[model samples]
Target: MSNSVEYQQSGSVAVITLNDLPVNSLGLDLRTRLLELFRSAVADSSVTSILITGTGRMFCAGADISEFDNGKALTSPLIPEVFNEIDACPKPVVAGVNGAALGGGLELALACDYRYAHPDAKLGLPEVNLGIIPGAGGTQRLPRVTNLKVAMDVILTGKPIKAGKAERLGIVDRIATGSDFLTGAIEYTRVQTVSKNSSDQIVDFKGNDRSHLEDMLKSLHPVREQSKLACAKALDIACTHNLEDGLKMEWALFKECHESPQSRALQHLFFAQRQATKVPGLEKTTLPRAIKSVAVIGAGLMGGGIAMNFANAGIPVKMLEVKKPALEKGLASIQSVYESAVRKEKMSHSQAEMCNSLISGTLDYQDLADVDLVIEAVFESMDVKRQVFSRLDEVCKPGCILASNTSTLDLNEIAAVTKRPQDVVGLHFFSPAHIMKLLEIVRGKETSNEALATALQVSRLIGKQPVVVGVCYGFVGNRMVAPYSREAFRMVLEGAAPEQVDQVLTEFGMAMGVISMGDMAGIDVGCAAAEANADEWKGDPSYQALQFKLKELGRLGQKTGHGVYIYQGREKINDPETITLSVELAEKHNIERREIGQDEIRKRCMYALINEGARVLEEGIANRSSDIDLIYTNGYGFPSWRGGPMQYADEIGLARVVAGLNHYRESLGEYGELWFKPAPLLERLAKEGKSFKDFQP
Candidate 1:
């Protein structure tokens, strides 16, 4: 029996159990054992039918994503090879799914002759969420099991389909009812093997596009055939393109995403996000307390949205705002979001009402005395947050975990004002907390394990994925963005118009470009952060120049109808006036302008962030690479496909990236801050021909 997987003959049946815990992941070890098991099962005369099931609750979650960053995996073709062997097995193979079967898990099951799923099991191919196409047999096998339309949807969106839906789609043979999933599957297997059905007989799957999708392809546009969103209008893209062509299209699209600055930035963000939680040397432990009731101080956008998550999770909450008007506004905002969810069919009207009923808005801090946790979503100002935390220190219960939703602030300083620093933590929520999935759980220097546990548990209860991080000025996500933005602005100075820079990025598969993002976030926000950093980092001259000039001119982005570009309502109206103004400012500062290509803009913008992330890792801001990826993927819309920035660095090859950085450094001669120098860890890794991927964190 191998450590990752094992198979044993029990009379005529080979019982194949995946030994990986929690969820049996298709890592290098599992793939090796699975292959060995399949070989013995196929060759042994005593074995007739093979029954595969996971040891734990899950059949298989997917591949070992963490292994993607592991250095030894630079060239491994095990999962695909194992899947091929499973598909080519001479005897009938049965998959007994005890829990989830996702991505490669679902791909492996699809290759089997029949699949029996537990009632609670979910099955799907969700590789798209990570910004990569399923490199496994998903693109090939899914269409064979179900209609091409459904396969396209599953492959593109990566949404998990329940067992019932999987059965309806003909992806599974039957749904077993018993709590003992293996017993139910074995009984079915016994009945099937006893029948006259031939061992070599292949299972039949009817694809919806089998008949006419070929003809449908002649009339479709290239973009419609290529873009995932465009598939909505045309209906059957797989019908038009051959299976090989479709796979190529997927790879091409994935490559486009890979080349994107947004993808690059997002990948960096994903890794950075995962690193957010490693409080240096803090012991990871479970606490006895569970958050049943929550007190949200400051019923503003973040507070109200966070309250919705709690109520939706069946937790009762008391929402505290400063005044009656503020309370009413917060409640109304909550109601509006619920109504939107109802319209989208995300939640039932009754469910919405139940969630709404769980939240009570009031003005008094005393109402939070008995709450299990209190999260303050106060204004970004340190003085304001400090005052709110001080008040919470006086009123909340001794055991109640105190948290701040402030995106950027020193959690330690805020905790210092409290009676118990160990009880204070930072649980930073992305905007529209109810809608977004990522929660940044920041632990200050004195925060206890119990406090961290409460925050992490509460995050799950609210239907949010929480990645904990250590405290910094802007925490993990925001701090990393500084370098990326600096280079984006640098592109503007280098004679690439905002739209051209944006176009290249968007074409590369980003939702939008840096300029559009800046416009969306508002220039004032960046200007303000830069101003704060200018004073905070102490005579940071480069940041000071942009901050002081932008604020002095009152050029505040969308809210002011102008900043980098003018806007009318929601549509952006780029006035040549902006370009002229920008150039004038550059000239006034005597900064020379030169032509820059799309590639140059992207490299500078993205690599800048990755370089900064290396320092964060070395400084112990993040525990592991996975935590950083979890943050960016969940909170910042960092594309999951490239595996986060540090992962991307590995993919890009750090030695190659380091060479590019030094080249850029020479290019920027005078203006280059010695801070642009690579981190010691990064320098060592590059010299050794290693990548950021070498460090799991």
Candidate 2:
């Protein structure tokens, strides 16, 4: 037997401890050993009761997710087989959940006659997050212990419940408080009555009203259609079938989901998100500089939002503005966000007040001298950013990390004004910085390792995903977005309506369409960013021409109540003027307008984004392909289920993507050829019949 599972005897109770460190993930070896120990305990004449517990912080995280794609996980004595062995044992089996009992771990506990969990233990079936249903009898067993409503909620949403809540729901029989879980479980199990067959004691809720099940399904209806279908099928099997039949049906469904493209994409993203945190060459032992306090230079919306992140993390922040009114306004905006949270009951009044208390407003640059870090959230103009950095260099103390919150400006140029260029980095927080999860950490050419480390550490403290990218015109996200937006604009000139383009993208699982997103981000903002990279865009005259025209006409998106579409209190209303404008532009350029299908629109827009992502990878702007995926999913509203652009390209087959790009280039002639040419890396990968998964950089 493997040493991962150890068996011992305590009086009449057989104690089986799972000794695997770091959350005791049940792999093939551990599962095989567990089966051996369980059968041994059942056969021993002296052992009347069995107590299963785990050493270390967790009982078991789940099945070893690393083994999902490999065939080894399907070997004999699988998790379900082990659960069945435990269930069929004649002795009363007790599960001592020391910490988390998630996914298959929860299923293991459910197989036992009684469950006792540590107070801090969390229990749930979160397989839905990876686009699969619980395969090892979770759907059938969870509903039996808890009601259908609670079970569906837990399974569909993939949220864990605390042991206390689980106990209240009767999912856990008792809380093993103030004592070691194994000792408590042994003491509790010693007095329990042994049944002729423990498997027969499974909770039966066959006659219960299931109207609440429909309500729960309705509540989860907004998730992806595929996920909703999985949940519905699981619920149907649980509600209608017997235990054996339900298990068989669920296993089939689980296998189908596991083989699905959605599951593969989601699983790819699951690993990608974790892989994004690891810097290739950076030493693991290198620690970040100490950052206790931060200051923001500007009193605008961006500045206030940036300041709120530090304050929310319990770090003191100073907000600086040129005048007192502007400073007060910025402080008021920060306070309002907290107050709104209080009104929604998301936070206590005391917590809101405490968060607000950590922020202080100042009119003088000298007030920032004691701060450990200073971030400039001023205008996007290089002149404005340089002035702010130059002033910060003069007033800030030595060793202070200087950062720019510029989403599109050149970070190196901004850092050039300061003598301490090594300290300058980019913290590109999306709009509503306090709430958005993506924080692009732009490493300038001169940025030091210490400064990069500090920014990454601070991002985690503030509950953000920091993707460290090298400096460029628009960095990773925006630079890729430029091509994507270019295609959306060109589609308008080719006879597709703005709403049609938006609808096609939304159907493809984008959170918002390109035209609508541009309107929300403000047409002027995109125009200014485009103007900054004019030399790069000089080959295409019609690039963002409609946006420039809209800006000239004073239709500045949602803020101005007009842009690509007219807005009526945040609702986009189709207007005839945009179609008229597209026709005029098509005539001016001597281009023919024709009916464009949704598929063509989707291919053009998505291929543009994917091609740019390839260039970003080849240019070393991003460290890896997954980093681009992370940036798009977290920052640019790319669908997470599709696994971002690169993974999506891989799923579509690189050769097919190359063929599609070539088709567009040949169809549209000169400008199209220039724009639609696939990146060299993408072309090579396609010719080699390899996916982005084969990319090392």
Candidate 3:
């Protein structure tokens, strides 16, 4: 037998162990070997029962994801065949779920006559997360063992449940008693007292339950369009047919989803997220500095949120402000957040209290002297940031990682003001930092590997996805946002209504419309940021004219109840006043108020960002195209199903994106000429008949 699978006999029980390390992924070789061992054990008359378990923490993650890119996933003795053989076996087979049994792993367990899991084990079919449903007997067998509600919840959400919950839901037959899961599983096979029907023998569901299941699936508001397909098919297989027919149908449905553009995109993101973690030139053996305690400069909203992230991770934090009033306000804000979380049951009372206790407020910079790290989340001003960093350089202890949370300033310039330039990095956390998952780790020119490693480590500890980026204005996420948001505002000035512009984007899978997003994020805030960098857009005086006009009119956004749209309670009604203002500005600026098509709006806005993303890649600001996608999907509300903008551009074909940009450049006249020109990298790739995926960077 192959080393992937090990077979041993203990008395009348035959034990088969999955020896694949990391995660016992059912690759071609592993699947082939396991089948051989199973057949051999069945042929031996001395083996009365079989016990299958994995070596370590993971029973199995699932099928080999890498194999899917090639035709190896569809090779002979596929995952389904292994499950079919196990299901058809005459001898009783038991699965020992010692750890997480996800996706095809759970399907494997379902094929067994009985399953025993350690109390800490996690089990679920998370194929929906990858834009597919379980392809084996998962849909059929899961509904057979558990109710429709449990099966729907488990399959649709793609979230793993604890072993105790699995036992209650009837997904797992019994919870293993001892810490040694394999020993308990072997003993279970030997003493076989409880007589239970195999998964195939159990009926799908009661007559009345099918309608309820259908309603439940209908009520599901999945963000991804492909999830609707996967969910509907999973429900049909569960409620419509027997195991034999269902498995065949499941494979066909799985194939359909696997071949879809959305599936390919989702799979790309899964691999892209993992690849983003690896920093070039930073060895895997590099040791990160231990961050025992942290300090936050400025106790504003961003600083408070940043402190909460460290505190939530069980690290002590000191928040410093210039005055006691501001510090008190920040502390109160943190307390309110924790209190709300506790009320919503999002955090346990004890956990919330512990987190709150970890955050301490002070007014003196000297109080932060002993902190291992200092993050300056002050105003987005160069002079202000430099002053904070200069002071931090004097107060912070040796080797303390000095970080600036500046969203748009130059990190290298900020580092130059500090004595320890090598220790300075940028931890650009998104708004409500503790909640947002994305963290842009900006590596300054003089930043050491130790600083970068520590930032990555800190990101993991705080449950944030870190993407290391080269120092640049706005870094990766915010830098790309400029062109995307610019196009959104410019389109509105060109005659598209606020709602119309937003509706087009939402229909195309964006979480929210750009015009509405501007309203909600406060227009004045954006105007301020734009004015701060006024020197960059001096050539185009009419740039963001409507936005500046609104700011001048004291229409600030949701906070003021009137910006681009009039807010009435939670609903935003189209304000004729803003439209009238936009028309006046358009006429004054010699811009025509022509009707804008949805398709044009989408292409212009999306391709603008894609073009900027290509420029980011060409400039080496982003290591890979997928890293940009990761930032947008996590930080910004770019649809995960479409992949990132870069992936979307690849799928639509780079040639097509270039054509759109060129078309808009000529169609919009001066406006397009100013903003719609495709990046050189993008043009080169399109001319070469390649995609962003083909780009070396």
Candidate 4:
């Protein structure tokens, strides 16, 4: 009654404005007000057409997340009622979409007879990423409004379609110019609203003849069915209601998702993702320098991947490799990845070629001057990396942001050689940088806030999620990884075989278990990291035996056709000689071998990683729990459905986890103290019944 919804009558049209703050979400109060506004328009005899829009940057961000984020049971009779009420409105209700019309917001627009979008608007139904289908009439009305395939595509993938694409798809009636979006919608309603004198058609599908669409289906069996079934289910769920009955069906599904265990996890994940970027020192963090062009030093796997990421971001890259053959191979690898995307239909041939043209290879240091940023992705050796940074400091522009793609090197040492130490930052791009969604923005002590923000923006441009991290050994990923690997070693010392361990973990939703993952990543790398730590753990005879035995054998990994398991054509056909050596070495030290249960195996691997993650948070290495989750989910293939380890910890209860860590702390003693002891941050939060969100970045 107090104007939660406001009416601005402009001549022949009645404009209903939703003025709720912060993206104008359609929550319970807004829903009630929406009903009142529709009734007001209906009652006014002068109102011929209705133009509904929002008084914010976005039309709406869908339902209020506050309603469900706290593990609430979703009750029925939800969004469907609202949608049906819109459909039942006798007058033409036109929607003026501006900015993001996502989730239930898009569904609200669909309830209108026609939709008008601004040039910069984005439309999407992103429920699937949260582990729920479109519960609102999205499933039903979308297919009827567009073709079956187009509806399925929008629902399944959850990617936003541009205003131009939406108009072409007939999802929007028209695309408006840079004027008041509502004015165009009102004009459209004048032409479209039907009276007794003018009969109106209830159809708006006007898409191109996609008759050849079926031929694009996958030729492969399981992959074809996997794609087809996923698409079909998206539409099938939508067909449960007609336009008038839409609201009921939509609310029912929405409620199902609201009460789902998956939804609970996703809500935690959403909060975690928000936390991920919040590391301390953001107040002083400078944006990265504008990266229009980049120079990459080294053409090895990491360097090539860095170049490819820049190319994909539409930044011109001059890749400088020391040797001719190395440069050729790096460029070839970039081509191969792009070619694979085309073959898989992830990209068009033209688009792939465009991305490829952006990367250039050379052997000259003179090529570095014009670039805004120069990232050295050479060997992991400290001296080599320091030399590269020194050269970049001399040759590149004074303002050029310098970066090292080192997973474990010190950013301070790298920056010490550069004249402009503030410009130096660590851009730890995971393997196959272009494909990975994470780019760790590790700030050195002198790195400014503008540089940090610039790095965050550039990361978004390059299609990556950036998490600004504090400078430390191993940064965040490898730092936490050390404890996770320690647990893996402890698992081996116990009676569980590598295959058994892998099976238990794979079942937990990882793509591969720890042992198989080691083989896939090359055991030589892990052994190298361990050997570097040999002196630190010298007093512990057990660790020295495990490290030297692996180095003694030629069982490096799949690259050498042996590691944790022997490989034949991507198949592990034989048990590894290194594993037998490890077992023998353990027995010789009189280390007791008791068969560890599957639950313990899973807990040791996951909890160790999670415990270290908390430690990283306490030490200010990572900004937020969500940032770590983003790194793991996108970079390390941690299953999105379960959320990241931080989210999983919240779901499983931090109190329970703390107790488990305490158990390990007592039994495993000193080695356990290094990896098994839960962080004080974790202990406090658990005891207080709080969450990772309780901490500041």
Supply every candidate's count of residue pairs whose N, Cα or C atoms clash at under 3 angstroms: 28, 0, 0, 24
**What is candidate 2's lDDT per residue for 1-697, written digit by digit as tens?**
4789999999999889988988898998888899888899889999889989899989888888787773544778778878877877778998999999999999899888888999999999889888788888888788777767677778878899999999999899999876566778889988877633323434445444366555555665344546656766777668777777777888888888887777877888888878877876667777899999999999798898888899889999999999888888888888899999999998899999999999999988999999999999988888888888889999999999999999888899989999999999999999888888999999999998888889889988999998999888889999999999999988898899999999999989899999999999999998998898899879878878889989999999999999999999968899899999989988887768999998999999999999999999999899999899999999888998888999999988999999999999999988778899989999999999898878876
- lDDT by candidate, in order shown: 0.72, 0.87, 0.87, 0.74
Cα TM-score per model:
0.81, 0.96, 0.97, 0.86
Error of 1 at 524 (Å): 2.9
lDDT of 3 at 486: 84
Instruction: Flag regions of model 3 displaced more than 4 Å.
Output: 70-73, 193-200, 203-209, 217-223
Ranking by TM-score: 3, 2, 4, 1
> Per-residue lDDT tens digits of candidate 3, residues 1-697?
4699898999999999998998999999999999999999989999888888898899988899787773544887999999888888888888988899999999899888898998888998888888887887787778787777678778877899999999988889899988677888999988763334344465456656777766755775554657655666666765667677777888887888888787888999999989998988888888899999999998988999999999988999999999999999999999999999999999999999999999999988899999999999988888999899999999888999999898888899999998899999999999878899999999999999999999999999999999999977678887787778888888778898878889999988888988888887788878876786677677677788888999999999998999998888898888988788888888888888899999988988899899999999999999999999999999888999989899999989999999999999998787778888899999999999998888886
Clashing residue pairs in candidate 2 are none
In candidate 2, stretches whose alpha carbon ends up further than 4 angstroms from where it belongs are: 70-73, 195-209, 212-223
- How much is 129 displaced in model 3, in angstroms? 0.6
Deviation in angstroms for 424 in model 3?
0.6
Among these predicted structures, which one has the highest TM-score?
A: 3
Candidate 3 vs candidate 4, lDDT winner: 3
Worst window of 10 by summed lDDT in candidate 1: 194-203
